[model samples]
Target: MQAIGLIETRGLTPALEALDAMCKAANVRMAGFKRVGSGLITVIVEGDVAAVTAAVDAGIAAYPKTGGQLVSSNVIPRPHADLARMLL
Candidate 1:
């Protein structure tokens, strides 16, 4: 399985740092990070179901520490697969 996270929260660095920790904890492989727009970061990662769920869970948990904004994320099995293929 794969996961795609659209992080539209503040404090990009800290959020990313927390995300890194989460990914480590969840054992997820980070494909890369894409710039969606100003102050918006799209984090792309791939892993098993449990790992993806844990990553998203951790990201949501980290959102509170940032200040107020909630980090939104969505699972992208098919879309991510296509996107992955495009890159290849």
Candidate 2:
């Protein structure tokens, strides 16, 4: 099953750095990302739920413990696979 995870981080450098490490650890294929006009970085990563979760975890953990903007994440089906099995 494949999932597209979107992580919205506070800053660019830390977010990108954490993303790099998480990507390395999770072994998920990155589908590229871009900074929207609203200063949000859209991280599009494709992999299993565990992989995406780990990546998102690493991202949140990578942020400094204090004085940072809010960090959030969301997951969606990749839409190119078995929806039933993927849901499981």
The digit string of per-residue lDDT tens for model 1 on 1-88 reads 4544334444467557656756866887776676656666656667776677777777777666656554466655545667766532
Candidate 1 TM-score, true structure as reference: 0.69
Model 2, 1-88: lDDT tens digits are: 4677667666676567667866876867776576765666666677898888787677666656534564677767555566534433
TM-score computed on alpha carbons, candidate 2 = 0.69
Query: Model 2 residue 27 lDDT?
Result: 63
RMSD of 2: 5.2
